[model samples]
Target chain A: MPSTAGAALPERSRDLRAFAGPVVEWAIWIAVLAWVFWQTQRFDREIAQYAFGAAGWPRALCIAAALGATGQLIYRIAEIRRGRAAVPEAAGPEIAAPESAAPEGQKPGLWQRAKHLPIFIFPLIYLYLVPSVGFYVATPFFILGLLLILEVRTLRALLGVTCVVYGLVLLLFTRFFYVALPVGRIESFYDINNAIIGIARYGM
Target chain B: MEQFLDGTFNLFGDGQAVLIFALGLIGGMLFGAIPGVNMLTLGAVLLPFTITMQPEHAVMLFSVIYCAGVFGGAITAILFNIPGAPENAPTCFDGYPMTMQGRSGKAIGAAVSCSAIGGVASAVLMMSATGLIASWAVRAFGPQEVFALIFFGLAVSASIGAENLWKGWLSVFAGLIIATVGTDPVGGIPRFNEGSFFGLEFSSYYLSAGIHFIPMILGFFAVSEVLTQAMHISKGTRERPKAGLDFPTIAEFLSVRWTMLRSIVIGFFAGILPGIGATLAAFLGYSQAHRWSKKRANFGKGELEGVVASETANNAATGAAMIPLLALGLPGGALTAMIMGIFQIHGMEPGPLIFVNSGDLVWITFAAMFWANLFIILLGWLQTKTVVQILRVPFRWLAPGILLLAVIGAYALRNLFIDVWVMFLAGIVGYLLRRSGYSAAGVVLGLILGKLGESAFSKSMQLMDYNFFGFFERPISALLITLGIAAIIVSIINEIRGADVQKALMD
Candidate 1:
């Protein structure tokens, strides 16, 4: 059945050709293991000569792991051949449909969806900006931004919940956990931050 | 052993330990009840206070949190269909079904009781076994064995990612690479750090910036859930959890006796393996139980046995994981690793030396685990009613509140803005991968075990002359390797003849 599916595809199309799930899983692993092995190749080869040192166990383990990894790569290849192949399902509910029907733009295909790089990249940008904005400053905005994207209703509820939640967290961590929350430069704001810091450092 | 016995007696004698246990019980109940809050965050949030505590007492607080976290997750899972942890995801299957049938109280009761039993059983196993294992492990000086043990750990994790072995391996390798990003432990040279970003070597290795697990955890479990919840809310209809608890009948529990016993054993054994942790133990135990269950067809549709297997195995894994941690000074899971870190920062090295050098602390910690498990039962039951109430909050209010807490929790880890970003990215990845049928737990476990396996393997290489057999030469290492091989065969056999095994076990 998979062979027929594969044959039906355009011969030159590199993407979306039918392949077994196990095959795809292995192919991805081999690529990763190969990269790791290549990264350690020089040191791994050099370390092969030295013996009977304080470093003996750690180095040997690495090479053994590389070997184990290599063995797995081979096994995966074999397993992939024995299994039925899959082409990403083109049929699935759309995300934009009714909430019970589908989530926003989610479909069954994998390769077609990887094109949306922005979704994956957004979080990284958020993390980079968090400490600079400070917990108090950043959390409400993060909450508000995420809610808006998901199309949450009622701005009043969102604002109320965001403030209450953020305020509660500030009370808990600062008062209870005593975490040294980041407070960017400001002489006037220094004391409050310091008091929080002091509590975190000593009180808890 | 004598000291361990004495420490147990001490907790009862002084009542201070009991008070600590109470705090842990309450904390675990509350943390587990809330959707966004998890044990790791609770542990981290509570860590600073423990710094001034006696090592044993400090460990007790965290241990209570661990045991309770497993059971606590079911509160919302049963009532709201929201899993408190990734491990608890399976719980929502039967758990919520029982709730849907208006047996919410009974479901919570059975879950709590089974979880407590698993917890206490593993604790008993750990107490009895730790001394014996520690004595042997402490005396054994085979670098080959250590390397092999690490290999065994890697294999367990690798096997868990059966269909997606490659992605699993990549996750492990990524962790290994991350482990090497800092200064080489033996070589003492910065291998991965390009240099100071602005004249300061801003790296986990050079700057002693620890890789904060809590932030990562919060990001993956808490933050991701919030985003998913947000998406669900926008869809119009939201799940509102019903409140309350029910005590189980004697017959109901008696029928599950064999399952409970089997799960406890599985949990205990899984716990013994380093880095395997409760989630896998619960998963494996539940899978086995499901395969063998008389009501196999009722599993995903919400069988009581499903909840029993998952909860018991997870809870048992908690205590069992500590066996390796205490006996060998090798951490059995991520949370224990954090505790191990605390021990190191406090100038206590966990290996064989710990048993001999820090005998008092060792005994105390072992004793603490035992009592903490017992305390988890009392704690779980006490907060049973209170916790079920939290499930009553409307999804809209609860979702935003949880989202806020997730942000705070992520930010609290290292007080870094960047971790918040990591959480966000992980959330998106988690959501996307989950939608694609890839398990988020797999990813997290991969990220975790991958690094440990790499470091241990590398350490072995640095010692031996790249001889692969170094892993097998040591007796324990060889045993673990054998177990890994056998487990793979068993998993395969089980998968192939799944129906037969299910029939035989159920019968």
Candidate 2:
């Protein structure tokens, strides 16, 4: 009986791990809906006579989201329960592979997910820099940083690709389309920028 | 026929018109082939330049771009797993598989051919039926009917989440909730902007403007893809396959002729409906193909018919989407919405009366579309010769380039820094939802249709003395509502039966 209990432990744990993502999603949905429902109370109740006021659609949507999330939670739980019993070891590799390869102990932590952090962070940093540094000034650095994160080894290839892409965007947005890319702190920079634009448009 | 001939003569009579058509086709194709940049972005960028050209030339340029952009998205979808645009999502289901099978050239050829055929067929349909369809649609659809139709669109879009009906419904409702952030369509009163909710102060200005779609699309599809690819960067490079301009033979084309024809019909009708864009048309077309095909089991595993179905329907919707714009002054999708702006800028209002007021311009535009389709076939075939080489570039190098384009595309929308932040937030949300097996397309469809649906519902309420159930009293409205309910039931049944939900539907 003791040996039997030991064998069942890992299987049970695997099932729990599988349910973790769905549980978190459900919690997020519920929280969002709760906030939405609370906000609906603030909408003016007297504006429209028909079909509920400005809050009507939002309130209905919130309720529907709550119900849907609840239903999904139940369905996912059932699937996990059924899957553990019905799925066999002798089935196809795609189904059996996960069970056989299950980690013996604790799941990987935040450190394991850290590899994806830089790629996600790059966009955020780029956006923050765009307004102050301006698009033309910010883009090359942005591309250079992303390339380094993506593991472009050689400096030559990195600089070459960055320059080409930046030049093309500069020509297209500034010269051809005349899109007002932010000028940043230096107002006198416009003279040089306009000269480059002139060269692109009508030749020096 | 006379008008078409006259339009054709006028188009060729001027070298400038021909040059503009060629440039629009090439430029749109290039933009659409990039993963994060779409034709609508290209249209927005070129909109300023159109100010300098004749109104006829501007219209012609936009028409060419619309046709080429729709077709160009399939190129990357076939060669890479990434879709160039949302409408190309379905194409990636089989297209990337075909690439894995070293049939990239053949898949691309079929995609281009079918897309051109679908575009030409819809253009013909538009020429023949736009006047009649417009007049009838304007007369037949009141706010109540339009609301019902939008509700039906939402239902059909939700049905796309066949793997998880509840999650799909949740996504749809979440999208609707997001749409309600701005001022009410009827009352002009802000609903969700208060001092603080959930410990975050809601900005009245941001809430009033609401979220833009392009930024959301870039985040959901492009930014999320970057994160996903980053995780897999350690997998090392795979072997590259040989690809070229290998157009399908007559027999090969004939084999999928029936599929293409059905897709064209499906796409044309889907386009006529307001707010139902190319993405939904592609999904519906692919789903119908899976339902009808004998080898449905082989669909996601590199089936040629899958590529044909998606590309054909998406491009076909391009022409059909223009019908409402030309007929009722109602823009169908982002691309048409921008085109409508261009029309207004050029002093040619696009309504039923446009045919009378700007008959020559209308004929010229139709002629341009025809020429544009032909031009895409030629230019696309040439593009295939070199585009396949993109796979040879290391993904590590390509990833950063894509990221740059994604940023630029987001910023280009309104040149607003806040939009960029919105895109980043949307990307995180998209990544989470995708990891949880929820459909991002459902969320996007909901976003697209939500505003239209709410406004129509509110207007209809005003029309019918506040009785919500009165939506079902009208014949067309009743039919639409019944269809919407039936679609939900069918999707639920499909889910219960454990049908093989195609990844194309999960976009």
Candidate 3:
């Protein structure tokens, strides 16, 4: 009986660990709602007498959110207590790794998660370059960079795909639709675009 | 009925109209068949070009795209087990299984035929119902009634959240707060700007201009999908199934006729209700099919009825979703919201007045939907072999191209760099919220409804002479508000029951 009881103790502790992340998330959400409520105080108070004033709806929504978050936190706590567990497993991790490493198995480490970071980072860098390098110049490089990050290693396949995609987009958006893609500081960009459009339309 | 016939003939009379319809159908199918590329993204990309076209042509193009896009997603679902759109998620249950069993042709055939039938039926329903609803709404609804309806929409949307009801409500509140950042709809005063919080120049122009829906959508759906897919780049691809033009037998079609009809009814009604879109319709339809079937054990194991149930319902929703948009100016889902934006761009507001003002345009749009569904069936049948080939495209190749389109779509909205930044920021926020079990649908619904809700509330306040209780004085508004309350109560009870079940499991 002692051995069985000892075995159940670790299982209960693991359950508690699972609940920790959700509890923290709920607490953070509550704090954010409280901040939102505080922020509403800064709205123009002179118009507060109106039933649907500038601040009226916002204040109501903030209060409701705060209360909801508080209720969720309390419910989660009660759940933990009643289940005789420290935590239950956090939701949203069934598909991916959990927020924290479980005692039973390996969690996805920082490096594993960071591998996908370039998916987002590349877009930011591409957008930043668009205004300076111009869309026509920046797009190919963006496509090339993404393909590389996605681990497409064959250079021939990369260039061929990039050219096809870029050429189609350029022809469609710039030539057919006349979309004014940003030309950056390059005065020659327009000339190049027009030359391509002219060739496509009237033939070389 | 004569007007509908005339509109249908008139649309096909012009050769340009046929060309545009064909283009939209083909384009929508190609884009939507690719996983991570949806109708909304394709619509956003094409929105800029529509400015140069005639308004009727533009409307027809988008309407066709909307219909075809719903059908397109099932192809990938059958071939790849990855749903091209959220509405097609349920199709994957039996669709991919059938592909594994080498019955891809039968599954595809049923999906195509049922989708077209469901779309035509829903379009007919929309044609009959929308005009009546519009006339009634125009007569009976005031700002109070509109506010009550939008409130009900928010409640329904929150109840459908993927996680806990409270979290859904929280997301809705957060969305409402985000919507409040720009100029107040009632007062035209900028709230939550740099002046209100930090004294920074960055928020001056962009905040005043407000967050464009196009950028927000492109970020949330397209960029987030790109990132998610990027994470799975290391996964190996499956060999493409040999798709053939094997049309379903007459007997098979007859067997599922009742299921198809039931799904169409469910999908149409669900679409009429604001914020409950095709995803829910598909789910409800599939579940009902399983419940009503004799061979329920075969449901998830390559059942043809499952494919029919999901595809038919989702396709049926395409036309029914437009009912609210045309009648009350309330968009029920993302696709309809984008269509609403197009309506606004064409200088035609999509409220009850649209029926009175541009009734011809509405009828023409309805006719266009019928033709679009026919085109989907005809074209999908003819191109089954080619369409299925899209599944063989590597994700590594597909994701970047979609990312480029997302950037281009975001930029084309207003030709402002700030809009691009907004899209990026919204994408990050959407990703984080989605990762935390909060539904992005709630936030998006809140954002779409926020300004309309605010205007209605403010108007109601003025109409009632500042008496909050006066909302109950109107019969329809009172009924709607009661419904809203009932919805919230039901959601909470469900949440509590779910928690109790979880507790029992743990114990």
Find the 10 residues in a row with the least total lDDT in model 3 chain A: A92-101
Choose 1 or 2, whichever is better by TM-score.
Answer: 2
- lDDT for each residue of candidate 3 in B42-93, tens digit (9 for 90 to 100): 7877888878887778877888898999888888777655456767766766
Per-residue C-alpha lDDT of model 2 across residues B207-312, encoded as one tens digit per residue: 5677766677677666765665565453232334446446678898888889999999888877777776687688778867876887765676678898999899
Can you rank all candidates by TM-score, best first? 2, 3, 1
**lDDT, candidate 1, residue A5?**
82
* DockQ comparisons of all candidates to the true complex: 0.17, 0.34, 0.33
State TM-scores per candidate. Answer: 0.70, 0.86, 0.75
Q: What is the per-residue lDDT of model 3 for residues A56-143, given as tens digits with 9 covering 90 to 100?
A: 7777777787777777777666656566544333332111221122244545688876776787788888888778767776778888
TM-score of 1: 0.70
Pairs in steric clash, model 3:
A15-A87, A16-A86, A16-A87
Number of the top candidate by lDDT? 2
Q: How well is each residue in B60-152 modelled by candidate 1, as lDDT tens digits? A: 677777777777887777775556775675566567667655567777887888888898788777767776754554466345454455455
* Rank order (by lDDT, best first): 2, 3, 1
Candidate 2: chain B TM-score against the reference chain B: 0.88
Task: Grade the docking of candidate 3.
Answer: acceptable
Candidate 2 differs from the real structure by a C-alpha RMSD in angstroms, to one decimal, of 4.7
